[model samples]
Target: MRLKIKRSNEQRLITLPDGATVSDLLNEIGSASINIKVGFPPQTIDISDTSKLLTDSGIKNGEMIIVTDTIETEVPVNKNEVAIATVSNQNDAPYVQIDDIFLVLRKIPDDNSCFFNSVGYCIFGPDSIKYPDSQQELRQAVANVIRENNQGIYNSAILGGKSITEYSQWIQSSNSWGGAIEAQILAEYLDISIWTVDIESLQVYKFNDEMASRFCVIMYSGIHYDAMALKLDTSLDEEDSQICVFDKFSELGTLIEDNVLKLTNHLKNQGYYTNTSTFILQCQICLATLQGEKEANSHAKKTGHTNFGEVN
Candidate 1:
């Protein structure tokens, strides 16, 4: 299998046999002996030291890879060790809590929406802040946390059915206005509640009044499709699951059966490529579902099993 590579801002290509793991492919390209960096925003795995990254991240053949040479510099200390050392050095300094709320807000409102595509965002004050590192594993962990905290903001018009671009804007938007508009938009659009957990003060705030004042909007609009889907599912299910549970595959079914003609017609008529394309694609998905259900029912009848309704 051929693998396209972008390393340290340079274009280089490499080839690997089919079914090769990242480690195996690196070996074939004489890069296994060197430190290899992978990931969109740049993350490194010391292939020369640890091959576990490949196995853990499920990196395998025929996939594009980005590898970078290791940068040598000052001696590094483990985070925990550094924290301990800092605490020891400063007698009166208070220790930082692991779950402390660390908010970094920007003040740029006209930021290009594309910036949010790079990360995941959420509404819960404590659950939203992701780690600083971009390591794939850590990023995934942060994504999971955001997913858990974010309940239903995705399906809302705040996202406008454009997940990638919408999120990019959220990430780039500054919190200079205390993120008031962004937070309010998310709350109104997603129709969910947000509460802040102050670890240091042990105070829980229902509204981020200070947050609003410091930034124009507290934006965590960026998110992956999976996270968005999860939020959408939770939101729809809350409104009488028996009638409105919206699964990805069953999206068209829910839309049509629930009589969402106005919304769907507006989307189709508006020529909003993002929503229109997704809706059209969902039609194909629903057709496949109908076919599958038909086959299942046929088999059930032949086997003398009870028939469950399609909705069930």
Candidate 2:
């Protein structure tokens, strides 16, 4: 029997035995380098029920099966904020401040891979042993996602001058940078929503909002990005390993008020957010001066220097 498997912007026909189980079909496709071909991790076949055989699942010869990477998990929702909460009382402005809400920002290295590193940190936390090569893994994963979806979403027009192949190669390059585009792809690939809060503008950029099962909020200064996790309750002992996870922005707004308010304020107090146009940045390592954040970032990338201070 021939089965049509549709996945990641491409569809293929596969031959299988008449009595084969869904598991058997998946196993057959799994070994055929499907993951590599599709540029995603190994996916579990969803025939509504996994235990049923292909024939039992209503799969017939020459029938089509749509493959999807997202598997809905039973995440508990905070009932208090099921409806979208207004961010502000002033005619729905973007930024809002919540009382008693705090976040712990996990700083990633100032390397070009901060976006990837922050994503890794959000997914696996700060344990090096558990996620030793997460940054590299994610970088390659992003490239694969782009490569697999090339003809459609990641085509040349969207990528500017570079072709799909060039963009894919660049995504895996360490020196090549990752930004909002990469973040959106990562969110889709991971089946999560990423809320990127811009410190200076106090603007929130959401990626994969439509199909997100979980939320990973990260702080984005104009020049860099860092992971932000809810600070555990002070009443809880430090030894307690439990952490708070927000499954949706509405839940966060309902629970924490304006989560970005505290984050933006913290960034302001730490001198992370500044008016980059007029800010003077001086390299502490080499004593070289740059006009603004963009120039400083370019200098740092060119010189392999991470130490820099704003010279007011």
Candidate 3:
């Protein structure tokens, strides 16, 4: 069917051939090239300007189509911390001090140094857990977990110098509140420096203006969002929305590994041959055959301390 077209932006008039789809006309138009004349500037028209006409006046066949261009003042998104800013000041543009930032970033294991070390020794109980004593050996332990399990945690999962991608994965999928809660649990168990606090508890007065703005977005998202969204809509377009924040902040689950044995193998390869602490701790909780009183007495006798009183 013959179709009359109207656009909202550029002024132009165009006619479509019979049995044509909107897709077909778009492909034919190519780029913004003047194709046909429909009317004068007083009533210019273009297919791109169809939105206004479509909203105001419905399209009709064999009718003279009218288009109007409305110039919209673009909103400035640069002011939003969650938004990307253009290079206006070449000399004084602030750089993101990402070196020490840990809290709000997602893909935890990727950006932080500890996560990298953890990933290297995935085979052991605490896959690549960072000990003050040995770093490289811990990294090997992490790698071993990955090799044995053939998978790795998407989020940070360091337990005393061993990485546990499986635990991280479990925290992500099964939890209702998201993986942040589980990540917090793991961080707590390992005594790692992954400090996470709710936005509601944050003191606004402590942060400066720019920091306040970024913090506002992070808080609103419940620290669940990897990259914070700016309050202003225009801020949405400044940076690539997908990669707004390169650091890992979201509670991503284990991207690698499935079984505990494979994870142990990974640890052994990294020179982390045992999880005796984990085993002993578990044994103390379960195994009815074990004597807690005797163990506590032995500890008290060996150290000459009264700390074993709780064990009785």
Candidate 4:
């Protein structure tokens, strides 16, 4: 039997035996797709239940299945804008919570440089305006850090089968993807602990777990990464400050330890977690929407409109 798996703007056809289960089809899709991340699982809703066997789910041959590789939500986050969520108060500090606890986060552009931009935003805040170029530099920095320690902690296992030079070149590429590996390298480079939260699994992946006054926490919904910040309540203060600084790790740590799991469960219950990926690529010169990557690349090559952003 054949089924059509629709992912983003692309669709793929997969063949399966007549009695294949949903898990079996998922395995096949995992093997055949390159866009899906390794650790993050793929899901489907063809027959209303994700775990039901295809044969038992009333799925017909050549049925079109909407395959979502990442968590889906209609989260309206723009580049340079912050994401704030209201939660129960868990702390008594001045910036902690006066009324409702808010989880503040910054949205990075949905490009290959998201990890770098996210790290940069956490580090320098609005001062980090370098964007794609800064991301390129940070990639080189990560590669350099690995190359300097190639014979020691950084090895082929860490690089995922690439040599030091090969990995260095790969990271420097504009289209190369970044994730926990890059986050770890950036953490060591900046000497700060980086915490990555997976929205689907509700697991916090920490890098450079040592104590630090200032650190970073990013939200990972499988494919893209976004920076997480704390929205402080400044009603008592005479002046309003948009950005809040953490004096101790315990402040944010306590909140995450106490409320992150509950918040995740709440988000799931509210159906805030979704699996939809749609990026609008506009020409920097004329602001026209390009058809796809090929057309965007062709436009850049012909008209030099290299400055493009993903409007989601």
Instruction: Give lDDT per model, in order.
Output: 0.30, 0.61, 0.27, 0.57
lDDT-wise, the better of 2 and 4 is 2
TM-score of each: 0.26, 0.56, 0.19, 0.51
Model 3 lDDT-worst window of ten: 251-260
Off by over 4 Å in 3: 1-166, 176-197, 203-217, 220-228, 231-312
Candidate 4 minimal-lDDT segment of 10 residues:
34-43
Per-residue alpha-carbon lDDT of candidate 1 for residues 1-312, written as tens digits (9 for 90 to 100): 556654433445676545455566566556543445444322445454344445455455444455433322222222232111112221121121111110112111222221121121321111112322222322233233334436554433544233543344333332111222333433333333333222223233333332331111122221101111111121222211111112222433223222222222332343312221112111122232223434543543354332222321
Every candidate's CA RMSD: 22.7, 11.3, 23.0, 22.2
Q: Which pairs clash in model 2?
A: none
Q: Residue 23 in model 4: shift from native, Å?
A: 66
TM-score for candidate 2: 0.56
Better of 2 and 4 by TM-score: 2
Pick the winner on lDDT between candidates 1 and 4.
4
lDDT of residue 143 for candidate 2: 79
By lDDT, the best candidate is 2
Q: Candidate 1, which ten residues in sequence have the lowest lDDT sum?
A: 222-231
Best by TM-score: 2
List model 3 lDDT by residue over 1-312, tens digit each: 344343323223466654444344445444344323232111223455422342233334464332222222222322113212222232221112111111112221222233222321221112223332223433333334443444434334443222355433322221112223333332322223222223333311212222211111111112121222111122222321211111122211110111112322332343322222222211232323223435533543454332211121
The regions of model 2 sitting more than 4 angstroms off are 1-101, 128-132, 155-157, 235-244, 249-253, 274-312
TM-score, predicted candidate 1 vs. hidden true structure = 0.26
